[model samples]
Target: MNRRGFLIGLAAVPVITGAGVSVAASRYTPDYEPLLARLLALQGKTLQSSGSWNPSQIFQHLAQSVQGSLEGFPEHKAAWFSHTVGPLALQVFKAAGAMQHPLDQPIPGMAALDPALSVDYALGHLVATLQNFNEATGLQPHFAYGNLSKADYLAAHQLHIEQHLSQISVVA
Candidate 1:
């Protein structure tokens, strides 16, 4: 009711939201099977794309992200963003069990997508890249999200794929 009370309430918002994010991210279980299963399901489907990127280009982009963790991304956000905003965003994504970002945006500093990349080839590359990520020992810090535990990275990757999946569908 009072201006002071209103200000106090507003200031409490982040504290409350932060607590919720912390709890949600902690309780969220990381599952890699769905990622693999979804890819496997795409094995023989005719997919129609509704996004700027083709089915192959989409897969290529996803593969590049996974590879970036293993090899290294060419560039990254400033340390401030990578350490602060990036992690905060990731917490929200983990808390919500999804990622919301520009669907067509390529990973910064990466090569452009190859129109010549076939759907099947890109699909296989993603599958293999994911496997390599799983087997790799050290993960490079994410370009934006900074260093993530393998679990968080896997969860992030899975959510990223889930988000992209929304842009395409199997054509019967």
Candidate 2:
């Protein structure tokens, strides 16, 4: 192959590989069952965090988000923002089947997290929160995105967890 052809072929590799990964990731729906299973598998494991928050903090943060979906968010973006930019952002993330956001930022208006909380406690809260979310028939409005259907919330939660999980490394 000529240099141009070879370069074009090489460029396709990542695109193809990424498409395959996205398909596989989407196959496992990000809902309570799969999330619970993942959490259970990690029970009692030691983990190191690559992000600002430790594993415990991550778990608590996730739990808080899940809980917030059921009970209304403590704070919300302006209606115009939620109606415009927020929903657009959510749709983009949903289309990609992934979410990206600042990791260090906390939910607006929520109380400060207790950094000293044990991983086990945090995990328990996460699991329980997921379960509660699954059983809930009605959902409250999201802080930024405003209103979301049950399916949308599940996907968002899954993407959020997946993003956070990327920062976690099991400590041997």
Candidate 3:
């Protein structure tokens, strides 16, 4: 999609500010504006994760999901699940404007995140992934959500990020 088309597709996206299950400030947002802004705010901050993974891992995981939409995911849940439960799950999450999932779970076939991954690199990768997603055409099927319209996929990405970002906190 071209810039104009992407923007047009996003014209009606609802703002998801503070729509999350986490106490983390970066709340839910289907649109990129607030999520990207939150990332920018984290650029120089000291971040700690309350979850099993570190902040870098969380960022990398989020990047992988977004990247998956553009390139394709390596594995997928059973088709029945993607065709049935997956769409239902996306709808439920969208209705609440938040997502809930096991934070420690890695994407089905992806390797474990490197413990030594740099926060800066992972964070930058996520930023770039989101940017690339904006103009992405022919998005690949989601690992679980199956195929989705660009708008729905964007919502999925943002909600997924919202949930993970909740695990991270900035040091004072």
Q: Pick the candidate with the highest TM-score.
A: 1
Which stretches of model 2 miss by more than 4 angstroms? 1-29
- Candidate 1 error regions (>4 Å): 1-12
- lDDT, residue 6, model 1: 100
CA lDDT, candidate 1, residue 113? 96
Residue 86 in model 3: lDDT: 90
Candidate 2 TM-score versus the reference: 0.81
Candidate 1 lDDT by residue in tens digits, 54-153: 8999999999999999999999999999998999999999999889999999999999999677888898899999989888889999999999999989
Q: Which prediction has more favorable TM-score, 1 or 2? A: 1
Q: Which ten residues in a row have the lowest lDDT in candidate 1?
A: 26-35
Model 3 error, position 129 (Å): 0.8
lDDT of 3: 0.84
CA lDDT, every model vs. true structure = 0.91, 0.85, 0.84
Top lDDT hit = 1
TM-score for candidate 3:
0.81
Q: What TM-score fits each model?
A: 0.91, 0.81, 0.81
Residue 101, candidate 3: Cα error in Å is 0.5
Residue 124's lDDT in candidate 2? 87
